[model samples]
Target: MAIISLEYYSEVLGMNREVKVIYPEQNKVENFTGKEIPVLYLLHGMSGNENSWINRSGIDRLIRKTNLAIVMPSTDLGFYINTTYGMNYFDAIALELPKVIHNFFPNLSTKREKNFIAGLSMGGYGAFRLALGTNTFSYAASLSGVLTFNGMEEHFDDNPAYWGGLFGTMENFKGSENEILPLAARFEGERPKLYAWCGKQDLLYSGNEYVANELKKMNYDLTYETADGIHEWYYWTRKIETVFEWLPINYIKEERAF
Candidate 1:
C-alpha cells in the first residue's frame, strides 16, 4: 500500500487543509481493468486529526489486500458541521474534499456504489451525516459514534460555548441539521446502507442503540453490532476489520497486453 499526504487550499474552509490517503498497491503482473478504485472517506474522532486511523488503528495494514483507497481528512473539533463561529467543515467534508480528491486521484471512483464512509466518536456522527445528508456514499459505519447530541449534551453540558459554537443553540441542534435521527428521517428516497458498532461498556453505547434502532424502525438497511468492550482504539481497530468485510467492494481483474 502507498500513503500520500495532501496539502491544499480549500475554498470551502478558506484555508489550507491536510488529508491522508492510502492507496492499495497492485502487483506488477496484474493490472487494473479501469483506472478508478473504490474509495472510503474515513473520518477521525474529536481529539484526532487525519493521522488518527493510520497511527492508531493501522488502517493501511488492514486494507492492504483490498482494492480500496482511503481518504482521511482532518476536521479538527468542528464535529463535521458548518460551525456558527467559524469555517464550513461540513461542506469541506461532504463536498469540496471529493472534488479535490478526484482532481488529484482520478483513478479513484466517484460512483455512489463505490464510495463509502466510516468514522469513530465524532467522526462516527460525521460518517452518518455526510452519507445521509449528501447521498454520496452507498454505505456508512459508525464506531463508538456520538449519535445522540442531546444525550451527550445532557452529560457533558458544562462547556456551553464548545457545543454552542459548532451547533449553535440547543434548539438548532434539535433540527435535521445536527441530529442523526432527524437527518435520517428527513432524507427522501433511498438511504445509504448503515452499520453501527459500539462497545457495550462504551459511554455512548445507548446513543448508538438509540439511533440504530430508529434507523431499523424506519425500514433502513442498518447492521447494528455490540460486544463486551469499551470506547477505545482497540475496539475500533477490531471493529473496522468487520466494517471492511461489510463494505461492498469490487476488485477488478483483467488480462493486460504486456
Candidate 2:
C-alpha cells in the first residue's frame, strides 16, 4: 500500500486544500481498468488534518485488505462545515472533492454503489451529515458523531454565523417549513445503509444514541453500538476495522459469480 498527500486549489472552496489518498499503489497507475473501484471518504476529528487517519491509524493497511481506496481531506477547525469565516466545506466534500479525485484518478467512479462515508468525532459528524444530506452515498458510518443540530440555535444562536458560509440559516437544516425537524425528518430518501459506534464513556454518547433511537422508531435501517472507551484515537482506530468488516459488501456491484 502507498500513501500520498495532495494539495491543490479548489474552485468550490476558493482556496487550497489538502487530501490524503491511500491505495494499493500504482502497480499500474494509468492502466484505467474501466472498472469502478469502491471509495471510502474518511474524515478526521477537530484539530486534525487530512493526514490524521493515515499517520495515526492502521487505515492504510485496512484499505489494502478490503481492496478499498481511502480519501481523506483536511477540515481544520471548520467542524467540516462552511462557516461565515471561510469556504464551503460541505460542498467540497459532497461534490468537488469527489470530482477532483475521480478526475485525477480514473479508478474512481461517480456511481453510488461504490461510494461510502466514514469518520471519527468531528469527521464522524461530517461523514454522517454529508451522507444524510445527499443521495451520493450507498453507505455511511460514524464513530461518535455530532448527530443533531436542532439545538444549535440555543447553543450557538448568538453566533448564527457558526456555519453560515455553507448554509445561510439553521432553517436550511430543517428541510422545509412544514418539516420542522432537521435532517432527522428528511433522512429517508433512498436511506443509505447506516452504522454508528461510540464509546459508552464519550461525551457525545447521548446524542449518538438519540440518532439511533429516532431512526429505529422510524424504521430506518441502522446499526448503532456503544462500548467501554472514550473519544480517543485508539477507540476510533479500532472501530474502523470493525466498520470495514461490517460494511454491506454483500451488495457488491459485481454480479453473482455462478
Candidate 3:
C-alpha cells in the first residue's frame, strides 16, 4: 500500500487543508486492474488532524490486503459542522471534498455503494450527520462517537461556549441543523447502513445506546455492539478492524502475503 500526505485549497473552507490518503499498490504476482476502487472517507476527532489514524492506529497495515482507498481529512475542532461562526466545514466534507478526492484519484469509485464514511468521537457524529443529511454514502460507522446532545457541558469543559458557536445555542441544539438525531429521522430516502460501537464504561456510552435504540425503533439498518473499553486508541483500534469486516472490501489474497 502507498500512503500519501498532501494539501490542497478548499473553496468551501477558503483555506488550505491537509489530508492523508492510502492507496493500494499492485502485487508482484498479479495484474493490477484499472477498475474503480472502494473509498472510505475516514474522519478524525477534536484535536486530531489528518494523520491521527495513521499515527495512532495500525490503519495503514490493517487494510493492506484489500484494494480499498482511505481518505482522512482534518477539521480541527470544527466538529465537522458548518459552525454558526461561519466555518463551512459541513459543505467541505459532505459535498466539496468528495469532488476534490474524485478529481485527485480517478480510480476511486463515485458510486454510492462503493463510498463509505466513518469516524471517532467528534468525527463519529460528523460521519452520521453527513450520511444522513446528504444521503450520499452507502454506509457509515462511529467508534465511541458523540451522536446526541451536542450541548453536553462535560464533553466541552475546556471550552464551555463550544456548542454555542457550533449550533447557535444550547437550547437550539436539539432538532437543530447540527443535531444528528433529527437529521437521521428527517431523511426521507434510503438511509446509510449504520454501525456504532462504544465501550460500556465510556462517558458517551449512554448517548450511543440511546441512538441505537432509536435507530432500532425507526427500523433503520443499524449494527450496534458493546464491549469493555474506554475512550482510547486501544478501543478504537479494535473497532476499526471490526469496521473493515463489516464493509464490502474486495480483498486481494496474493497481495496480502507481502
Q: Please tell me which predicted candidate would have the highest lDDT against the true structure.
A: 1
All candidates: CA RMSD (Å):
4.7, 6.0, 2.7
Write the candidate numbers in order of decreasing lDDT. Answer: 1, 3, 2
For each candidate, the alpha-carbon lDDT, in order, equals 0.86, 0.74, 0.86
Global fold similarity of model 1 (TM-score)? 0.93
TM-score: the better of candidates 2 and 3: 3
- Please, what are the lDDT tens digits per residue for candidate 1 over residues 1-258? 789999999998889999999987876213544467889999999889999999987777676667889999999999898888877999998999999999999999999889999999999999998988888999999999999865566533677788788887677778756788888889976789999999999999888888888899999999999998998998998788888889986433332221
Would you estimate the TM-scores of all the predictions?
Answer: 0.93, 0.82, 0.93
Give lDDT tens digits, candidate 3, residues 129-187: 88887868999999999998733655445565775687765666668767777777788
- Candidate order, TM-score descending: 1, 3, 2
lDDT of 1 at 92: 91
lDDT of candidate 3?
0.86
Candidate 2, residues 43-80: lDDT per residue as tens digits?
Answer: 98888888888778766655543456788998786766
Point out where model 2 deviates above 4 Å: 26-34, 149-181, 249-258
Error of 1 at 254 (Å): 23
